[model samples]
Target: MMQLTTGERQLGAIVLIALAILGIAMAAAGRTDVLGIHGAMVLLYSLALLFLLFSSAFGPEPSPARLTRYYDDPIKVGVGLTLFWAIFGMFIGVWAAAQLAWPILNFDTSWASFGRIRPAHTSGVIFGFGGNALITTSFHVVQRTSRARLADQFSPWFVLFGFNLFCLIAVSGYFLGVTQSKEYAEAEWYADIWLVIVWVTYFVLYVRTLALRKEPHIYVANWYYMAFIIVVAILHIVNNLAVPLSFAHAKSYTIWAGVQDSMVQWWYGHNAVAFFLTAGFLAMLYYYLPKRAERPIFSYRLSILSFWGITFFYMWAGSHHLHYTALPHWVQNLGMTFSVMLLVPSWASAGNALLTLNGAWHKVRDDATLRFIMMAAFFYGLSTFEGSFLAIRPVNSLSHYTDWTVGHVHAGALGWVAMITFGSLYTLVPAIWKRERMYSAALVEVHFWLALVGTLIYVFAMWNSGIIQGLMWRTYSPDNTLVYSFLDTLLAMYPYYIARAFGGLLFLIGAIVAAYNIWMTVRAPSAAQLPLDEDLPASDRPLDGAAPTPAE
Candidate 1:
């Protein structure tokens, strides 16, 4: 059982009392106009407050400790949520893609329109799916590298449950037409507040656990994850600065106006992609790649260099998204310059990952998990190069509103983020379930090929169509008139859209195969004994009894 400190209890009580007082004041003001969604929000807030108070009063008690080793139940729950939400989120993404390809797929429903559903897809994948995966894996990676059991089951559960609950509110509110209308920051003020609380708890738990690590050296993955958590918290608070219309329902306006608002939003938005999608996954690659390959990291200095370089440069690149907009010319120039500079660190990590597997190519041939990770690294390199190129003003002019941007994003999201996630999940499932091996290596191979081919086709088709659309949109006739109607551009994209749909389908099939493989592995009977080879050190194991060096 875990116990709370007196200070923690007092803090919890104070928060609950404050919430109660606020609720009563709102009710007394007769400001029912803001009470619609705000009222519901207040109730939810009160409930969360009460739950925290109760938790502080009586700390968590484990459920009998049924397993011999502490099973890291919080991580397990987080993993389960990740899988569940991944499927749901991806389904939404595929549906949205289909809507893009075929307008009628929206079924004329307001809630299902592209505007409403697009944010849903983004939030679902980024927050619901990727968020859970990152939390789960961070917990797992931290415990393993640190050689320490998690601090407590309850706090982890609180972090996971609270985050997912926030996702639920945010997504539901989007469909209900409640929004701040900022891209990626679309969630209303209440949703943002909930996420802030959940995120702070996550930061506290993560920092505390790291402080208690049993290992001598903190692994490189921890650096990336820590950067992600801290930077994101800062970005969230700053970009989400808004005055609530009322607290009873989901309504608020961003405090920053005009070009300032755009600057803040994209600063948060692009960095959200950089830190959340890129940096965190890079951390996964750093830890998992060498562990799976059973080899030493290729370059320690390179990893450190890449980590610092990326951290310094990425925060500025968000301004590139505001290129040719109301943003100042100097700011945009800085964004462009930093974005270009980013290629060096990005490729440094990519090179380190690929080089780490110099003698492990044979394993890649047979290990589906390794294949996913390796391919993910390859795409990471590809996407970063593409991102830098896209950030150029001339290129941005062409690609900004075109499907090319869409293609570029999916190349990163599906290829880099999704692939790395799948690879990590593959590595994790057996260990978590105590299985000897996956159910079928052949199915994993099939999945790898399907996803790889699908992603390639999808990205290539979009690149081709997007360039064409951009050129056509910009071209004027000899008489200096518009050369193409919007409809003509739309028609030109039909083939590419169809190709994209096919690619998405193929990827979906691969995911399904992966899910089945994971399911079978989980269901498989435990081996009579653990494999001895699994415990053996590689021939090139580090001397001096130090931890293995981390790959970039």
Candidate 2:
């Protein structure tokens, strides 16, 4: 009755044991530090996983026939975890936004404070929610495009659970006041090291699977995904170079300092947005958008152009964030220039996604899921343009350190990133679960409108709030003295802050609706279900007349 192969069970037990030992050492070494808490977590979670693995070991081995279909169990768990993180992350985000509008919500508890939960919200959504979605879809997309199963069963689960473990440790540490203090790289040295291990395995898993592809030519979606993995690995290693105070302690000093640190961090940071956020999801869009629309990519050449443009232009543009600062003026100007140039390819990619729907506009009109993807493309075009414009030195002067930057980020994040993910998941969930459709198509429409309205409200509020802040800060009276105090600006922001919080709440509610819908979809009885098969499963594409279409 084992759901996994004996080899897989053995591997799971071995890995969990190693993690347990590491956890024990951590507990002993860092009893006085937050490291101890993380250690306890690692130990407990490892034990739980071990228990689950062994409990199913008493039965006969799973049939090798599973190898006949796509390796989908990991994909199934990934779908659930993705929705789980979406709910958790989005809820925390709404709470954080609410805290900003109403300072009293933190309840005077240190753990509940804004400073503590803010990073949790960021990591929870960015890494937890968005990261899981990327990993899940990558697994699904790779198998279909290659017309091959995952290279192995074990590595997929390792990457999934290991990455989640790192996320848990990173976010939990923030509640304990342990951070390396870098933007988007806030997890301390230990978590960063763990992520590196998981990511390397992920890269190998992808490359190895692609090596066994039945298709002669690799697909464009795979190209973007590979770019995401390769570039992010390089960026994470470089930006996170640091020396821990001790193996037991969570604190660490970065290898970089002053302006050099700033440059390296953004070099990692902006490209993180480029590769992790943009490239990976664009991969999702490439495959799911076309498949869902039942259309080929409009212009294969445009996809390539956008891919290269993003890869090249985004590296230098991080400097634009440092405009009018201690960093060299020339560097700032260079960042600005590349950021502007980035618009061409960004627009190209967006256009390609939209153009794929040429004859499918009627489908888009009728299907909320398709509309989600279509609007995601529209927002992608808009947000990239806004990013280039804001990167201008003069614009950055006004927008920097204000809520406008926050608004611009969500315009891409909530609109482009989350929207595409939701659209794809809606399509992917039922297919993987072997259902006819979602539990409720009507609910999808409901979630779509909620998400759209929420994003608009949230973004517009920040835009207005940020502009007002900049103008007030820069304004002068006839006597040439500044007209507004910082306190005055703060007071003016309360109403917009309320609006932002309300919008965020709406988005969170939408995620909840999605969670329930997908949950029911999985629960709904289906007579035709893929038999849970074994390692290197073959897909039924050949028999069903649904061959793996080239996802160019």
Candidate 3:
């Protein structure tokens, strides 16, 4: 367990007390105003304060002798929170989908509108689910690869709680109709500023840990994570450069305007995918895939090469989203060119993952976790390829406003991002908790199927609907007039929307089961624990005198 210093404990207690007081104030206001969103935030803040207070009073027992070197508490908390946010995010996602299919589900309330909750859902999953996963896994991977504990114990908790605090504020603001009108960057100036503070602390802590490494060389995964953290911070600050109307108001305006703003927004948007979603998860893939398969990476050289390649190419590729817009044609072409080039590095990483499993094919069949990682790799290749293709002007012409882009996004989001995360969590949760195995390997299998089938259903439905919509929009009548009205396309998409909602429901169910499995594993008797030797595969056992490598 983490041993907090006096200052750290005092800081934590003070923060909790502040949150509790804020919650009490919010609850009082909510009761008088009947403000649903404020009531929700009050509940969240109160429960969080209670949980922190309880944990501080009665912390987990100390790490056993065998685990003396590692710091696992932050990783454990992160994994649990990742599960919670994922389920919460996807639930909102499914509801949002249902509301689109049947608008009545919006309940005609401003707070419950699809517009309000859409950002909530996106932020919940992206920042809440994916962000926590990256932070937790980075801590785990960085420590293991460097052969060092995190540099500062309190910092990880600070990052975890501070980042989540920003997420909470962002989501609550969305429900309260406060935003900066940016797509993924919708969090208002105050939340954005808070995130900046939290993120800088995160970067300092990460570098500090790396500086303390006992290993001779830093691992490949850390490079990817470093890029993720650094680039995201840069992108976030630059793109969210907004001037608030007043300190008392949530409204703000971006520094850039018109075509420049459009360019900057997509520049930030696409790279959010590149950095926040792709690069960070790639870090997870690099560490977990080899460990789960009981093999070394196929090529450290390839990993390094691809890392540089992705970082360089992905930044220039965001302009593709601005194709055929008011932006200069030359800029669009530049984005298209770089996006296509990104395929090489993207595929290199995917190939490296698959090739690492050269002799572990049987493990993929037997180990559900390995299957998740392997499939994630496959889908990573597919998603990147599809991304490059869609970036082409001609392709974007058909896909930009259609559901095809939506399908493509999910192909990566669900197939690659969520899959790899689920895989890593399964591998991580057990090790962090010092469990012999998951409470139910069978349930992991169930999750794999549900996720796979759900993704297939979701993507294919969107693909079909998107294509139909696009073709209909482009079609001309015998006299060179439009063949179908916009409403016609909207009506055509209903069935597919219904289908997509069902798919989301399936995925949500799988996540719930996975959460339950994790909870049960954590609760399982210590008597069920196996020896360390029994937990590792024979092939994974370190040979005598072998120096510790990244996965080892």
| TM-scores for candidates 1 onward, in order | 0.86, 0.95, 0.90
Tens-place lDDT digits, model 1, residues 492-534 = 9888888888888888788778877777666554544433244
Predicted structure with the largest TM-score when compared to the true one: 2
Q: Give per-residue CA lDDT, model 2, range 404-479, as digits (tens).
A: 9999999998999999999999989988987778878888999999999999999999999999998899999999
lDDT of 3 by residue, 262-310 (tens): 9999999999999999999999999999899989999999999999999
Off by over 4 Å in 2: 1-3, 529-552
**Which candidate wins on lDDT?**
2
- Name the candidate, 2 or 3, with the larger TM-score value: 2
**CA lDDT of each prediction against the hidden true structure:** 0.81, 0.90, 0.87
Quote the RMSD, in angstroms, for model 1: 7.9
Decoy 1 TM-score against native: 0.86
Give the Å error, residue 415, model 2: 0.6
Query: Clashes in each model (backbone N, CA, C under 3 Å)?
Result: 5, 8, 0
Task: Give the worst 10-residue stretch by lDDT in candidate 2.
Answer: 543-552
Q: Report the Cα lDDT for candidate 1.
A: 0.81
Ordered from best to worst lDDT, the candidate numbers read 2, 3, 1
Colliding pairs, model 3? none
